[model samples]
Each structure stands twice: as C-alpha cells, then as structure tokens.
Target chain A: MSTATGLRRLTPSSFLLFVAVLAVAASAAALIVVYRTGGGIISDQERAEALAERDLLEQVDVEQGLDTLAAGVTRRALFATAGQHFGLFDARGQALAGDLTTFNPEFRNADWKVVRVGVKPRYTVHVIGSTLNDGAVLVVGRSLSNLRRFERSIFYGFASAVAIVAVAGLAAGLVMNFLILQRVDAIANTAERIAGGDLSARSPVADGRDPFGRVGVSLNAMLERIEELLTGMRTVTDSLAHDLRSPLTRVMGALARAMHEGATEDERMDAVEVAHDEVERTLNTLSAMLDIARAETGLSREMMVRVDVAALVEELADFFTPVIEDAEQKLVIHAPSHPVIAHGHEPLLRQAVGNLLHNASQYAGEGTVVRVSVEENQDTVDIVVADTGGGVPEDQRGRVQERFVRLDPARSSGGSGLGLAIVAACAKLHGGVLRLEDNHPGLRAVLEIRRV
Target chain B: MVEDDAEVADYVAKGLRETGYTVEHVPDGRDGLYLASSSSFDAIVMDRMLPGMDGLSVVKALRAASVETPILILSALGQLDERVVGLRAGGDDYLTKPFGFSELHARIENLVRRRAGRSVETVLRCADLEMDLLARKVFRAGKPLDLLPREFKLLEYFLRHKDRVVTRTMLLEQVWDYRFDPHTSIIDTHISRLRKKLDEGFERPLLHTLRGVGYRLSEQP
Candidate 1:
C-alpha cells in the first residue's frame, strides 16, 4: 500500500499508543518520587538509631567508667538482635570487647558512616563512632538490608505496570481499527457495486443505533428512490412510444390519402382535415404531458401566491355549470361563506381542479349530479369533485394516478390519460396529495394542497 | 414579424397578407428592433428566440426607446410563467408555438384594434344586441335578457370584439380568466346557450361558428 494509506490506518492506533506512553511516563515519575522519599525516611531512621546507641554508650562511659562501658558494650554485642551491632577498639586500632572483627584507625573518631563488618557473612551497616577516654573508641551500627529490599520491590512493581499498560493499549487500538475499517469497507463495497450498475445493491444496515448504521439506512433509501425514478422513466418512455405511435400513424395515413393522385378535391380536403385534427390531438397530448412534467418538477414554486381557493372553485363551478347542465347533469357547489385561502401556484391549482371537473363531466354519464366543494382543514385545503356515477375500484385508484394509465380503454379516446397524473403532480408540488375515494355510488377526487 | 424560422415566418407573412395586412418580416432581432423603432406598424409579432439578439431583449430595447407599437410574443416555451415573463417584458400578448393561423390572425387583429384606443363605453352594441358594462346587464332588441354573471362577462367580451374571430383560447382567457384548455366542448356549450338567448328569435343570427377555426360575432354572414 501507499504510505498515505498506511499512515491513515495507523492514525488511531498511533494516537492511543502516544497516550499510553504519556501514562507510563507519569507513573514512572510518581514511582521515582515514592522510592526516593522511602529511601530518605529509612536512612534517617537508621542514622537516628546509630546516634542513640553511640550516645548511650558514651553516657555509660561518663557515668560508670571506661571499664564499665567496655563491659556493657561486650554484653550488648554478644546478645545483639538481627539488625544491631557494636564495636569497641583501642586508639592503637585493636579490637577490644565487641564482635567487630575488622577495625580501622579512622573508626576511632567517625561520627556517622556506612561500613562493612564481620568476615564469612559480611554485613552492611549504618554506623556512628566516638572517641572515649584512656585512648578507647566505641561504635554503634544498624543493618540496611531491609531498605535495599524495599527499593528493589518498588522498581519491579513499576516495570511490570508499564509492560501491562503497553500491551493493553496496543490490543485496544487494533480492535478499534478493525471495527471501524470493517464498517467503512462495507459501505464502500456497496457504493462500488452500485456505481458498477448494480442498482439492487444496498449498504447493510444492522440497525439505526449507530452513526454508521444510520448512514447505511439513509443511503439505502436514496438508492431506492433513484431506482424508482429510473423505473418510472422507463415506463414513461414505453407508454409514450405506444400512445404516440398510433395517432402519428393515423396522421400519416390521412396525409397519404390527401396526397393520392386519384383523390377528389372534397376527398382531399376531408383527408387533410382528418390529418389536422389528429395532429392537434397529438399536440394536445404532448402539451398535457409537458404540463405534468413541469408540475412534477415544481420549478414554478416561486410564483405561488395566496389564493382564495373557495373563490377559485366557485368560479370553476360557474364555468363548468353550463356544460354540465347541457349534459343533462346537475351541478352543485358547496363552499364556505368565507374565503378558503392557500398558498399555491394559481394556474396549476386551477388546472388541477379543472381537470377533475372535466373528468367527472366526461365519465359521470348523463343525469349524474356533480358536486364541487372546497373544504379547509387546519393545515390543508381540499378541492373535491364528486359525481354520482360509476366509481373506480379501490385497486385501480393508485394505478390511475400514474402517467398514461386509463382504467377503461373505451374512455381513453378523448383524453391523454394524464389528467389524474397532472393533478397528482400538482398536489405533490403543493406538498399534498390527490386521493381518489368512493362517494357511495361514484368517484370522489380530493385534491389536497398545503395551506402554506 | 421578427422570426428566425424561415417556413414559419413565410407562413405567417403569407396568411397575414392574404387577410389584407401589409406584412413585414425580419429574421434578426436587431434588424426587427431597428425597423420597428424607425417605422410605424399596426402591430409587431416578435418570436421569443431569434438570431443575433433574443426577442425579450429586443422588446425591452424597443420599449426603452419609446416605441409603443403593440407586440405579440411567439414562443415555443409554453411554461406557465413564460407568458408572464413575455408580457412583463413589454409584450401585449403571448402566443405559444404550433398555433393555428386563425388564432394568430385573431390575436394580431385584437392587438391592432386595442392600439386603436377605443374609449371605455358603458354600453356595447352589436346590431340589436346590447351590453351595459356598468350595469352588468344585457338587452336584445330593446328587451332585457336575464344573464348570469359569467354569461354577462362572456357576452361583454363578444360585444367588445364584435365582427371579429374569437378563438376558444381567447374566450377562455378573456371571459373565464383561465389558461388551461378543457377537453370537452365546455366553451361551445356556453356559447350555444348564450346564442340561444341572443339569436333565438332574431331574424338574423349574429353569433356564427366558423367551422374548424373559431366563432365570429358578425352582423353579416
């Protein structure tokens, strides 16, 4: 691997190791402080004991006599405890009445020092010496093996602590790096597969309990939306081809008939008119499709204004009343006494409501009563158009909202099969929905738009 | 007319000329602006997309230069706000592409007639039919006719542009204040009902349907 990647992988582990090193250094400093203080305390106690012993022997010499002092030293040395010792020597450096085997002339006037005494089993001692009368010397000492043993144990304890901390830090760092890299790799693999044209691939989301899992869940949702759009686009293209082709073929046939040499002027004119009507139909279909696409994009949201929806619906009801009456159907409008207002693109809202009314008039059959009502809720406004005619089945409600989907092929001749689709798009643009419901014996299309 | 498409420009010029209009066409926006500012015409048909300069810029430049000739913008862009943009850029009217010649002709005629500056009249009369704009009433042959508010508005528009071709889109926009085209013959039904009220017992019919084109409210056939 490149040095960059290697450094990246080592970053977390290295940071943890640095922290461990800091901890070890701090602990070592503390241990050294304890060791030094303990050794100083031990040395002070040993020196005090040696000084007291010397003083006591001197007192004996002063109170009793040199002979008595010498005898006392001999008695104490012969029955000494484990960490006690004494020595008495003449000025001539000769051992007198103590267990001290080796003696030096320097010991005659030594106040305090550490010396080695005895032969076969050597002993290290803290000693104090003083000159006595009649050219004699006395020494007092204590063994220092206990202080050495304590210092050694402290050193070993600190060394073991450092070892344990280093090992644990390394292990934890490795485990953390493994877990992070595994999660990252899983996400990367899923992304790579999707980029390689596998749209079905999704990042594994065990749960949304952690940041990584949340990212995976959202990523999968995004992929699902993308796939849905792609499928929708495919369906649109296929339907567009099938729907446009038939009308275009008819137009071509009419034109061919008009261009035929044997055709009379009247025949030619009729053919031309047929072609013209077919082309107009095709243009209308194309424009409706464009309207639906534009509404879906919601690009004209900047043009939204506060529109009195009830007034608009009333106006529409007025506009469609004559036509519905001509069809032998009665039109009724139920609107609030006050203005029902909403924020929306007025033209699109009008078009959506107009489409619903047109749909009802076209399919509600003769003698059916069409009702147009505007109802205001807390956060939404619904413009409903219901007709007492044969209604769409529940299963076909959702399918009818799709582009170029017609429930009845017989009723498809006059429309582009995109009326409800445009209405749905317009509803979505307004942050709402178009719901098709059963009005007992007919269809009730409610176009709900946000109040804002 | 300022247009870049040769066939479309030819077709429009030919149709207007056949209708007794002295037609002038320019394929470039700068030239169209120069000609329009330099000369006077009844109306100008400006294409939105043109060579050398865009149509909206030309319209703005002309308006800035104080050329007050009425302009009708022709655009392939049929977006909802595109018409508003064109009108806001000093255009008197907006016509989407793939329009019928009669629709274009009717719009041009309306533009020219509007430029003629008829004073606001309280009452509009076409033969025996009369509409009182202020009173919101209509009378045929000196007898009062009961009309709904929408029907009154529709008749008022027809009387305002009497003896001229009025397309369905025009009526939808002028009378109903809507832009979307209804699939059914809703306009036809409305007009037929109004015709029943206006010409039901009259000796001569005034509202005549110009088959395959539109309707014409003329005293003569």
Candidate 2:
C-alpha cells in the first residue's frame, strides 16, 4: 500500500498526461498524412514515365513498321540503365529483342501494371504492353525501388518522432511531479510536527507568491493563533489556581476558627461572616474570569446592539459620582450634547466602563479629579476614564491589563485583579482595544469600540 | 420549584417555606410541567437542566398551553446570551446557579408581584416621601427634592417595590438596566446619596440597609 501511494505521488497529474497524449496523437496524425501524400506522388511519377515510354514505342511501330520498332527496342535495351527495360515478342510469343526476359499475359494490353522480372535479384516494375498491327508485342517498364525507398523513409521518420515525444513527455512529467511533491512535503512535515506536540512548528514555504505559498502562509498563521490561545489558556489556569487558593484558605481558616471549642457566640458569628465574605469574593473572582473568557471568545457578541456611547458614559458617571465623592475624589464628565452611538454589547460595555471607574476610585487617592469623557470619530467611539491622582507607572500599565497581575502585593484594594482584564476582553469583543495611557499625573484608560 | 438535584430542590423548597410560601417541589421537568399546567402557582422556579425534559422545553410547553404563571429560570448557564435565551423561552426571569437564597426570594417576589398586575399608580408614598411618576419628581415632607435622572429612577424603583426586600443584583438590573456585577460598592454609594436626600432632616429613616443581603425601603423600618 505504501509503495502504491509513493508511486502515485511520484506520477504527474492525469491532466498533464492527457495533454501529452493529445500532443503525441496530433503528431502521429500529421506524419501519417505526409507519408500518404509523398508515396502517392512518387508512384504517380513512376507510372507516368513508364506510360510515356510505352506511348513513344507504339508511335514508332505505327509510323515505321514492326521491324523498325523491334530494332529500336533492341537499341534502347542495350543503352538502358539497371532501372530501364524493354521487350519485343513475335506472334508465337517468342522474345524478339530486350533485356527483360519474362512477361505476364495481362501485360499484352496497353495498360500499366506492376510485374516482377529478372533472376538472382528480383525487381518490381511498372510495365505497359501493346500488340503491334503485324501481330507482334512491345513492352516498356520502370523499376518501383525509388517509391518503396520513399515510403520506408517516411515510416522510419514517424517512428523516431513518436519515440522522442514519449521520452520527453515522461521526463517533463517526472520533473513536475517532483516539484509538486516538494511543496506538499513541506506542509505535511509541519503538520506532522504539530500533531506530535510541537506547537511552534511552522511551514518554511510561506512565500505568498503562489497558491502553494499562500496555503503555507495561512497554515502558519493558523498555527500561530493556536499557539497563542494555548499559552493564554495555560496562564489563565495557572493564575486561577493561584488566585483561588488564598481566599479558599482564608475561608477554611475562618470555618476552623468558628468551629473551635469554647468559642464565644459573637466570635463565631464574626468568623462565619468572614468566611462568607471570602467565599463571596472568591465566587466573584470566578465569575469575572468566566466573563473575561466569554468576551475574549466572542461568546457575548450576540448581545450586541446599538447603544448611545455618550448616554452610557454619562449614566455611568452619574452612577459612580457618589462613590468617587465618598472617596474624597471629585468626579466630572465631558461629553457632547449630541449622542455618540455605537454598535456594542450594552451590559459588557457598561461593566467595562464601570470597572475603569472603580479602578480609578480605588487607586486614585483623595482630592483626585476623575474625569469621564466620550469622544466620537467616524467609525469608532472612545470612552476615556482619566484620573488626576498618582498614576500607574509607565512600565506597569500593560501588565495591569493581564489577569491576576496586581501591583499591590498585599491586595489591600479588595479587587479581584481581573477588572482590567474584563475591560480588555469587552473592548476586544467590540472589535476595539483598551489602551492604558498616562493622565499626565494619573492613569487614563481609553476604551475604544467600533461604531458600526 | 423544578430541579433535578435533590440538594438544590431541598434547599430552595425549605427556604421558600420558611419565607411563608407554600412550596411544591418537582424533581423532573415533565412532572413540573404537569403540576404547573394542572394546578396554579404564584411563581415557578425552573432549573435549566432536568431529567424527563430540559427546562427550556418545559417553559416553552407551558407557555404554548397558555399557562401564564411567572417562571424564574435557575441555571448554571450564566452567560449573557444564555440569560437572553432563557427569558426568550417564556421565562419571566433568569437567575444563575450558586445564587444566595435572598436573591432567589427577592426575584421570585418581584416576579409574582409583577404577575399580580397592580394598576399603575401616579403617586408613590412611603410615609411622607412621595414620588410623582408622570412628573418624574420626588418630594419628602411635601418639599420638592431635587434628584438626578438616575436618582429619580432609583427612587421610583424603591417606591414601586416599597416594603419588599430588594437585593443588589435586583436593583442593578432594574434601576440601571445593568446585568453585570460591579466589584465596587457603587450601588451602596448611590443608595446612600438617595438616603441622604430622602431623610437628611427627617426623624425617621425609610431606607434601611440589610447587612450581607441588600436594602429595604419601608415606613415601618
């Protein structure tokens, strides 16, 4: 089976073979036609020469009498070359004069016929015979060796042409097959390596100049995306394990304390409350992680609708104003009078904006001026949540958007460390991005989404 | 409540009974559909996954039979679109699994009350606090209380469900039309501001925060 497949791979495609066959067939047809026409022309010339010689002899017999014709035939026979011959016979079928010694009864008429004469070296000839008025016979003939030689040459020429075409077609087929196999093998090798658990393997044939090259480029790109997703999945699981552990441990400790012997009612109640709060926090973290995953995977895209960006931001600002004010931060809004509408998932967008504001309220210290603004462009809308407090350091801005990457080791801010991650996911779901920029002195988070 | 899991069924049934609701629990979707269509109930808590039939099919069947009992779908499928699907399948509300009893109870009460269909009232009053629904205005002790649009909505929601326990999730969904949970205490802050506006100079506090559950607005409280 393997050998059969290998042979199949080595062979050129049937389409190429079909074209080669058609080319050979056309050459054969042309050669056959030329052979037929050339042979007919040679035979016609030979027959015409013999008939003209016979007609001249008949004229001599009619004008000068049989005795003169016989004398003429004898003289021509002596001077004739190996290809020329003549015969004269009496009424008793006896040879009168000529190099030719034999004749057929059918040659007695004045019509051309092919007859073989001579001994030791038989020669085929076109001959014509006529009975003179004195009851004598005259014959004239020519050898057909030249016409046979012409037909033999045509046959040999056609055979050699067919041989050359067959050899050349096979050679071209092999070379083309090898080139196609080389390209196919490059893709297959990459696929085999990937199947064998090498996620980073890529086809080396991605030239993007031909169909095979284009396929290779797309395949490599698909592999790149798969590798990225796998890496992301790994990080998410690792962080999830790490993040869930501490809260769970705290819950267990609180429960252990609550179950301790001789514990006072009030202390038991407090421990239970603590455990409950920790459990709630853990559950929130879990749900937030789920939300981020869903958004990143575009599972929430079906909920998208036309939402007014300005109105959403303004309402969120109003919703968070009291919270920011309670933290001793001033809250302000900058939006146009007209609505800035965008196609987006309303709930996710609201959550994303809420998360940004919540982050500001938590990190932006007292007396910070927090500004919420909505800017609209032709195809995109930007929701900017900027704070005028101690901003995040430039280097940490990008890292903060990743899940479970808290700047504070103590985790005193009481966040799930997934807020920015959720915001980024929401932005991506909306075919946009979340950019953490400098607010001069504070962090300015711009959540841009498409307005289609 | 229709739930395949015995533990969940017991927990919900016991909680509803403790809250003065006569609860009937079915452990399969088919049985739940039979009971719901044959008899009457103020509300139904339907689990999404069940034996005999799925919750969505059961809800669709009951609706097709013109059984208008309010249904609250309880499921572990808490994605945004999943919620939409549940509501579109004739469920009155959708609650995710691992929910607190108070959240479930509050939602069930909201569903049942909405089904009861009270005539629309223009003025809502709790003690001396009043809201003119058409005017979109609020007043405490007959003095006009200046409120923002969101504040007015919040007050209107509280007045509408005046003496009932409303969870934070409920308020988030109803007042702001938001379905995602905000990690910050943004709702508490809004409620506090509204509380200040309603009872700053008054002797009695109408808005009461129930620790670990949610808030309640009642004249007796």
Local distance difference test, each candidate? 0.87, 0.87
Q: What is the TM-score (0 to 1) of candidate 2?
A: 0.78
Q: Alpha carbon lDDT of residue B93, candidate 2?
A: 87
**Pairs clashing within candidate 1:** none
Candidate 1 Cα outliers beyond 4 Å, as residue runs: A1-173, A256-270, B37-39, B61-67, B182-184
lDDT of 1 by residue, A1-452 (tens): 79888777767667777788898998899899999998999889878878887898899999999888889999999899878878888778788888785786657667657777777798887778888877887888787787888888898888888888778867877887798889889999999999999999999988788999998999999999899878988988899898899889989999999999999999998998888877877777777777777777677787788999999999998898887787788999999979887998888887888889888888899999999999888999988999999999999999999998887877545688888998998999899999999999999999999999
For candidate 2 chain B, the 10 contiguous residues with the lowest summed lDDT are B177-186
Give TM-scores for every candidate, taking all chains together and pairing residue i with residue i: 0.77, 0.78
Total backbone clashes of candidate 1, pairs 3 or more residues apart or in separate chains: 0
Q: After superposition, how far is residue A423 of candidate 1 from its true place, in Å?
A: 0.8
Model 2 chain A is weakest, by summed lDDT over 10 consecutive residues, at A6-15
Candidate 2 residues lying further than 4 Å off, grouped into runs, are A1-15, A26-172, A261-263, A336-341, B182-184
